[model samples]
Target: MQQRFYDQVPAVVLGYDNALEAYRSDKFASFPVQPDPGGVIMAQNGVWGYYGATPTAAAAQSTGSNTGLVVAVVGGVLIVLLGGAWLISRRRGARAEDRE
Candidate 1:
């Protein structure tokens, strides 16, 4: 049923300040009405997330530079290297114990 589908969908509410910012943007044109300044903006599309009253300068900088992807790649490489080193050490320790 339609009610069941809606009940299972995730949603979020944006505070008035953030709602106003989203309302003014062309990107958020799907919003049906002009949200009240003192009220909340409910997600009609059943999407779940948060948005601040205004985009932060740090977010803008990081997005344009693809910093998150770079950081993730570096972190992943570090984890793999550490895991390999740990495995090698464990194997060496086991061999030493076997020989004693």
Candidate 2:
């Protein structure tokens, strides 16, 4: 049980020396340890767990490509303008025919 507990729980939770002491006192089982927020127990590379630093604003912003977003916005504007022009031209043609 002692070996299993040590294998399952990281020493960082209570610090190595404290963890050993807790185990000796039979208090380790009841000690509260926070769960991993990311829900990742083990990494693909066989690493015990992920301990990565939080990303900065600049790093987060650079991950995505803005080209697609810009293209979509430009395409939407062109469609609206072209539709408006077509509607105006059709109205003018109808007016000219009525005057004939």
User: How well does each candidate superpose onto the true structure, as a TM-score?
Assistant: 0.37, 0.39
Clash counts for the predictions, in order: 0, 0
lDDT of 1 by residue, 16-94 (tens): 3444334445233233322343444454333222333344355345436678899999999999999999999999999
Cα deviation in Å at residue 49, candidate 2? 42
Best by lDDT: 1
Top candidate on TM-score is 2
Compose the digit string of candidate 2's lDDT tens values, residues 4-89.
77889756354323222122222112222324442333332444333333334454554667899999999999999999999999
Model 1 scores a C-alpha lDDT of 0.57
Model 2 stretches astray by more than 4 angstroms? 1-61
Q: Each candidate: what lDDT?
A: 0.57, 0.55
Error of 2 at 29 (Å): 42
